[model samples]
Target: MKVEMILKELEALGSERTKKSYLQQGAHEPLFGVATGAMKPIAKKVKGNQAVAEELYATGNYDAMYLAGMIADVKAMTEADFDRWMEGAYFYMISDFIVAVSLAETEFAMEVSDRWILDGRELYGSAGYSCYCWLLGNRKDEEFDQDKLSEMLDLVKKTIHTSEDRVKYAMNLFVVTIGVSYLPLHEKAVEVAHAIGMIEISDGKGKHNLPVASVEIQKAVQKDRLGFKRRNVRC
Candidate 1:
C-alpha cells in the first residue's frame, strides 16, 4: 500500500488512551499511537519493502517510523541508511525498539552498533547497546566474537552506573542478554551484574530502581532458558 494509505490506516487504528500513554513515554506529536501488535497485519502485507519503509519513516509519525522498521529491507540498508534512521529516532522507544531491532537483522549490526556505543551520545549509545541485546538474543552464539563480547561486558561493568539513563537501561539489558543467551560469557555477565547491583534510573520523574540483571538471569536459569536464542529479531 502507499504511505498515505498506510498512515490513514494507522490513524484509524489509533486510540486516545494509547496516544496519552505514548506521549507520557517521551513520544512527540504526529503519531497515531498505534500499538506495535496492532501493526502486525499491515506489516505482513508489506513485508520487507525498503522504498516503502523509507517513505513511511520520512513521515516523522511515530507509528509510521515503527511500521518502517517492521517492513524495512535490512539487507538493502547501508550504514548511511541506518544512520539516517538513528537521526530520526527522537525517543528511546524508536531508538531501541525500532532502529536497534531493525539493525540487528543486518550484516552491519556489529560495526554500526560499536560506533554508536562509542559515540557517547544518549540515544546513539542506547541504540548501540540495545542492538547487541537483540543480536545476542536472536543470533547464534558462534556468530559473535567472544573477545569482543567479553570486552562489552567489561565496558558495561565499568560505565553503566555513570552512563546516560537510556544507555544504562540498554547496557543493563545487554548484561542480562549475555548472561542468558551467550553461554560463553554467562559467568562473566553474572559477575558484572552482581557488581553493578540495582541501578536507579530516571525518566524526568523521580529515580527508581531498574530490574536487577543478576536476578533476571537467575529467572531465566530456572526456566531452563539459558542459552536461549530467538527465532527472529523483528516481529
Candidate 2:
C-alpha cells in the first residue's frame, strides 16, 4: 500500500472520540485529529490483548510525546493527520500501515514508532523494543522456517500470557522470531549473527537504557544446548 493512502486513512480516525482522549494536555503537540471516543488506543494496549499489547508495548509514549525529539512537522501533521492513523487502528489495519511505512522513507518508521511509543508508555509498552526488533527482522541475517516461526510466535504468545511487563514479550518476539530462523547463533560469543535469528552486536539498548533484549535473546538461544529457539526447525 502507498504511504499516502495509509496516511490519509490515519487522518480520518483522528476525529473520533476515542482518539480525542489521547491528546496530551497543555502540550503544543501536533494534532492527529478530533480524537476518537469509540476506543482510545490505550484501551487496546491495556486490555491484555497480547496481539495488541505486544504491538503496543514496543512503543512507549512517543506518539503522545511527538514534540520531544524535534520530530513531526506539527503543521503538516495536524489534527487531521492524526485522525487517519486512529482510523486505521480501529479496523485492525495497523499492519497495513506498517507495510506502507516500511515502503516509505526509512526515517519515517522511527516517527510513527515514536508517536505510538508514547501511547504504549501510558499503556505500558516500549517503542524502542519494536524498533529494535524491526531493525533485526529487516536485516538479511538468515532465512526462517514456518514451523520455527510458528514456535517463536507461540513462545511470544506464551510470554505474553505470563509476563506482567509487556516489554519482555517485545524482547522475546525479536529473539524468538530470529531464533526460529536460519541464523548462525553462536554460543561462545556474547553476540552471534545468522544463527536463525541471532545478530552479532554488543550490549546496545535503543531506549529505556534497559539491557533486556540481549539478555532475553541469549536465554532463549541457550535454553536447549546452544540450539536455536525455533521449534522443530528444518535444517
Candidate 3:
C-alpha cells in the first residue's frame, strides 16, 4: 500500500464526469475524481499507515487527500498536523468532512473548533462548526459541557442568519446534530431551527438548498430516532 500505488489506483478509478461534478462542488485541479466507493478498498489496504496518509495529503491530490483522511490515525496526529491539514483543505469535503472528522477524534476538538469557527477564512470557519457538530454527535452527554453546548445553540440563534454562507450551513447542521443526538437540547434545537428558518447556498450554477432544521428534526422525531449517538464521525 505505497502512496504511489494507491495514487495509480485512484487514477484508474477516476472518471471525467465525476471530476466535473467535483469541480462544481468546489474541488480544484490535480484531482483524480475517484468516487468514494472506489476509495473504500484502497482505504482498507492502507488503513493505519500514518506515514502514508501524511505523504498522500502532502501531494495535494483531492483523491489522495481524501484517502489520507480515511487511513489517518487521528490519535497519532498532533495539533500541528491538524493545522497543516486545515491549511490544505480547499473544499468542503476536505475541510468539513475529512479534517473536521479527524479533529473530532482528538482531545483538542473543542479548543481547535472554537478557534476555527471565529476565523475569517470560510473553509476554516465551516470546518470549525463541522467539528463541533461531529463532537456533539459522537460524544456521550455526560462528556459534554452542557453550558457550552447551550451557548453554542444561542450563538447559532443569534448569528446564523448573518454568518458566512458555508459557515451558516455548518451552523445549521450543528443545530440538527444537537436536536437529533442530545435529548436535553432537542427542544431548544427545534426552537433554534424555527428561528433560523431557511438557509440557501449557491454552488456554481446550482442553488443548493440546505434542509430546514425544524423539519429535519421533526422527521427524526417521527422515526423515533432522536437522541441516538453515533459511535464515530469518520467513515
Candidate 4:
C-alpha cells in the first residue's frame, strides 16, 4: 500500500483511549494512536518494503514509525540507516522497541549496539542494551561470544545502579535475558542479577523499583523456559 493509504488506514484504526495511553507513555503529537497489534494486517501487506518504511518513519508519527519497524527490510538497512532512525527516537518506546528491535536483525547488530551502549547517552545506551536482549532472545548461543557476554555482565554489575533510568531498565533486562536465553552464561547472569538486585527508575511522576532480575529469571525458570529463543524479533 502507498504511504497515503497506509496513513489513512492508521487514522481510521486509531482510538482516543489508545492515544491518551501513548501520550502518557511519552509519545508526541501527530500520532494516530494505533496499537501495535492493530497494525499487523497492514504490516503483513507491506512486509519488507524499505522505501515505504522509510517514508512512514519520516512522518515522525509514533504509530507510523512503529509500523515502519514492522514492515522494514532489515537486511537492506545499513548502519547509517539505523543511525538515522536512532536520531529520530525521542523516547524508550521508539528507541528500545522500534530501532533496537530492527537493528537486532542485522549483521551489524553487535557492532552498532556496542557503539550505542558506549555512547554514554541515555536512549542510545538503552537501545544498545535492548538490542542485545532481542539478539539473545532470538539468536543461537553459538552466535554470541561467551567472553564478551561475560564482560557485559560484569559491566552491568559495576554500572547498572548508577546508570541512566532507561539504561538501568535495559541493563537489568539484559541480565535477565542472558539468564533465560543464553545457556553458557546462565549461572553468571544469575550471579550478576543477585548482585544488582532490584533497580529504581523514575517515570517523571515519581520513582518506583523495577522487578528484580534474579526474581524474573527464576520465574522464567519455573516455567521451564531456560534457553528459550524467539523465532522472530518483530511481531
Off by over 4 Å in 4: none
> What digit string (tens of lDDT, one per residue) describes model 1 on residues 1-235?
9888999999999999999999999999999889889999999999888899999999999999999999999999999999999999999999999999999999989999999999978999999999999999999999999999999888899989999899999999999999999999999999999999999899787899999999999999999999999899998
Comparison by TM-score, 3 against 4, better one: 4
Steric clash pairs (candidate 1): none
Among all windows of ten consecutive residues in candidate 4, which has the lowest summed lDDT? 29-38
lDDT of 4 by residue, 1-235 (tens): 8999999999999999999999998999999889889999999999999999999999999999999999999999999999999999999999999999999999999999999999999999999999999999999999999999999999999999899999999999999999999999999999999999889999999999999999999999999999999999988
Candidate 2 lDDT score at position 229: 31
lDDT of 3 by residue, 1-235 (tens): 7778888999999999999988888889899799988899989987888999999999999999999998899899998899999999988989998999989999989899899988879889899999988888888888888888899999989988777788988999999999998888888999999998998877667777799999999999999998888887788
Q: Best to worst by lDDT, what's the order?
A: 4, 1, 3, 2
lDDT of each: 0.94, 0.35, 0.90, 0.96
Each candidate: RMSD: 0.8, 15.3, 1.3, 0.7
Give the candidate order by descending TM-score: 4, 1, 3, 2
lDDT for position 186 in model 2: 27
For each candidate, how many residue pairs have backbone atoms clashing (under 3 Å)? 0, 58, 0, 0
Residue pairs in clash, model 4: none
Model 3 CA lDDT for position 6 = 87
